[model samples]
Target: MANYQEHAFTHSGLLADIPVTLLAKPADLTAMISRFGNLGDAIDACEYWYGPYPYDRVGYVLTTDGALEIPTNVAYPQFMTTQTTGNNRGLYTHELGHHWWGDKVTPYVHNDMWLKEGPAEYSGHLIEEWIGGQAGLLQAVKDNHFRVLREAHLDDGGFQPLSPMPDEHIYGTHTYYKGASVMHNLRGYLGDELFRQGMRGVQIALAEQTMTPQQFRDSLESATGVDLDAFFDAWVFAPGYSVFVVRERTVNAVNDSFEVVLNIDQKLRGTTVYHEAVPLEVSFLNAEGEEFLADIVASGANALHTVMVPFEPALVVLNRHNRLNQARTANERTLIPGVSFGSTQPFVDMIMYQTNLVDTTLVRIEHIWSGAGVDPATPDVIDVSDTHYWDIGGLWPEGTILRGRFTYAGATADNLDNALVDGDETGMLMVHRETPLDPWAPYPDQTVLAGDLANGNGIVNLDVMRKGQYAFAKSSVNVGMAEVRTDLATVDLFPVPAMDHVNVQLDGGLNGTVRFDVLNAAGQLQMRTFRSANAEGRYRLDVADLAPGAYLLHTAIGEGTAVVARPFTVTR
Candidate 1:
């Protein structure tokens, strides 16, 4: 027989009907009983949606094993009760939530584990909001979103659909985090009442029976009378999240009214159509600083609309309330909904995917500049043709090579030379300068990727190893001659898409003792080593143990930290 202390907590009437019991070592009886309120709170949250805890009694057994829903009881790890890094109550609510999804109704097959685990996981975040507040919930969602994006960047697992999961990844991020994300997205999409009714009805109907995905879908459909097939396809069956951007928004004054014209773009992470049309909000402020809202539904890849407002709007923005799902995180205007972008594609006038300048971390490119921010005089060699400038500023290390595809589409400014309305990239060259004081120069590795002179559409692949003023000009202009950086030691990694090991090459500027660090896509340090090298040398880094995903190489020269991060990937 096992020797253990059993503590019964009626929870001062909180769980009087469903008396809660905790069994653990004699030394921990007092601590377990003190935290018994977590269970009561979980029951309240679950019952609020699922109608009540299905089990007659609440029970938990403290063990070394991770938390699990074992019918009437939960096998909870001892450390979770005092976990400071994460929500400890979340652990409680998750297992107790399973009492409604798993204990009451089981999945017909293990493949359908998402049905129970996903809702349970989603409930954990909801409970955080329940006991704490919206701030708690937001932090929880932010943590999950970053984890999902980073994991997806790690192995593309987070993008996979919930059902038919690979044997090894059935319990992975897609099943739990994405599952929770979809639930949150649906709640926002359906509004609280419909989503609650749909979920509560489904949970009740599937009681005491094996549940399937379709069975769950049918119940929700019957309850709401809103066909959910499209929702399910885009969110559940599909492997990627919907990506939408406010491509263009223009306002013009009419007789006693303001007409607002908007152009919206949509693209799935890995596909074409975004089947579900979640409600999109456009907020406007008038002269008196009063807010007026207009709602639209995001339908497909491209949508254009005109709305009439009663007064001239001072400003307009998308999702002012931040009511949409938090499937990704952002820095300022950076809103990356999926994997980290090493090879970033920033929509000129759209949201950013926070691209970390120091590493290979995926980030959104935000247009954080305004016309009056820093107007520069014409380049030293401005031809008779009108020349325009686009400001660029962000973090960068000494000798870092910044290369990317510069794409310009959609005509905003009517300046003829400002766009490709009818011009061509004949001698068209990409130029940059550290600031307005420096001379403009041509960046290296310039190749014409795409050019549509007629549509004002074109893309040029080029590299500018430093952050500065950039502009497109003809070859007739000669501001400064350049290929790449010639400053501080430049670091470059070789054997891109590396397998066994990768080589780090140093050239131009670099010498003395150097600190080399490796970081996963999430920006977590994976390995660190020191090397003494000449101004130009090579060092080998073993990456066999690292998972196949995006990574960054951080090199520091001498006592001064000159961070030059070059992204590399590992493969099996």
Candidate 2:
């Protein structure tokens, strides 16, 4: 518990007719009252979204360290000088949000603390978004989501439900992060109008009272005229997080459109069955360029769903914005060989690994090319535990046959890359047309062109030109082809140690709009701009006004998944 000194200077301001005051120590009197004016505006912002401030007098005290909200007054640690106040304002807004959520509509018991903390935290993020725009909101959400995920990974004491208050020591992320995420998702599920109406209704109905999780859900349902029982049960009362993967896929082309069938598997171990209304944003791509966007939903385990698109999709991306709370984000999408290009010719990459419990260290990796009147050739033998890359040009064209065989030294050897064939084990093969930008796991939705076991020796029979050649190799191989088309690696930006401005030059071969986002060292978006590449695909940027410091420039070409990141500095 913290005690405030009685001897202090006070300044008063009107927060939309609601009297507000700032109390501070003698030495800090000037800075406190100066930034106190912004507190008034923060109150106004909260009131605009959450309705009127419940307390008549809002007082904030600047103290030594940390902060706490006690009814009408909040104790803040840092003295707000003009230079630092902008960064600390979020704390003020969050504490002020408690005036509505914590002080007025308090939770009846400790178990329901989410009613107090969840909305307050979410309000803080929402206020940042409102004040700073979409970029700010995205940064806030990504930061929070990453924190929650870190916490989730660290919790080895086992899972607990997010309601009725779990044990205090184990109550960190589930209470603050998971709760806030639930509110954020609920708002998305309810839409702007209904979510706003429901939130306002909850505030108005519970003012000067306490609410349990059920009561809050009831108020929202009553206001929005929608049944959210499933939503509450799975997200709020559930234990484990939702993890989904694409188990299988099938694609069929019809005229200018293609039909996609996806089998999504939800693998959350435990006795609890987690139900989710998975929101998906699908991006369709073709030779004409980035085509269009479509939204779809999948639910439950083994969610088999089909979607039709207006264009022949060269590539399809799911959960583009990363909206789902996926435990294993890998295998979210797969390339349809025949659909990516209207050809049967196969373009493939493979990784091979030697089994740990092997009788011999030597292993042979052989690729057999046959078909289209091309005679089958002898297998190329490569012996190693490390990564190897192979490129077969026009000889293995459309309708060509390709087979990958791994030979173990001994006749009793179980498999070519013999060992326990689990996702976690090495010697597992993964196929990809080109190496992905991010690590193999986090961005697994679309990497697979075709995959086969190293023990079985992978096999693929090319369909037509539309059916592309596939890649196969042992999993965990960090190698990619050097010839993959894309200027992601060749993107050039300078002056490295720039004072005024820097320029970014892309290969004229790179077509489409490139979004450039510049951020400070703290990962806060400093400036966001874009440039469009004409036929030749060339563009540049002017970054002269940025402050002198280290910064990151994130470049995403067009609407494609390819992104290039580079760090630069501005020196005085």
| Poorest lDDT segment (10 consecutive residues) of candidate 1 | 366-375
lDDT of 1 at 21: 81
For model 2, residues 313-335, the per-residue Cα lDDT tens digits are 65554544444443422111222
Model 1 spans with C-alpha error above 4 angstroms? 11-16, 34-37, 153-158, 254-257, 285-290, 320-322, 326-328, 331-572
lDDT measured at residue 382 in model 2 versus the true structure, 0 to 100: 12
Global local distance difference test of model 2: 0.53
For each candidate, what is the lDDT?
A: 0.61, 0.53
All models, RMSD in angstroms: 15.8, 18.5
Q: Model 1 shows how many backbone clashes?
A: 13
Q: Could you give candidate 1's per-residue lDDT for residues 369-478 as a string of tens digits?
A: 11111223334223222223344433333333445555544344433244433354333545555554555554433433222333444454442334454555544421
Residue-pair clashes per candidate, as listed? 13, 29
Q: All candidates' TM-scores? A: 0.59, 0.55
Ten contiguous residues minimizing lDDT sum, candidate 2: 369-378
Which portions of model 2 show Cα errors greater than 4 Å?
Answer: 1-15, 30-41, 79-87, 153-156, 247-257, 269-271, 285-291, 322-572
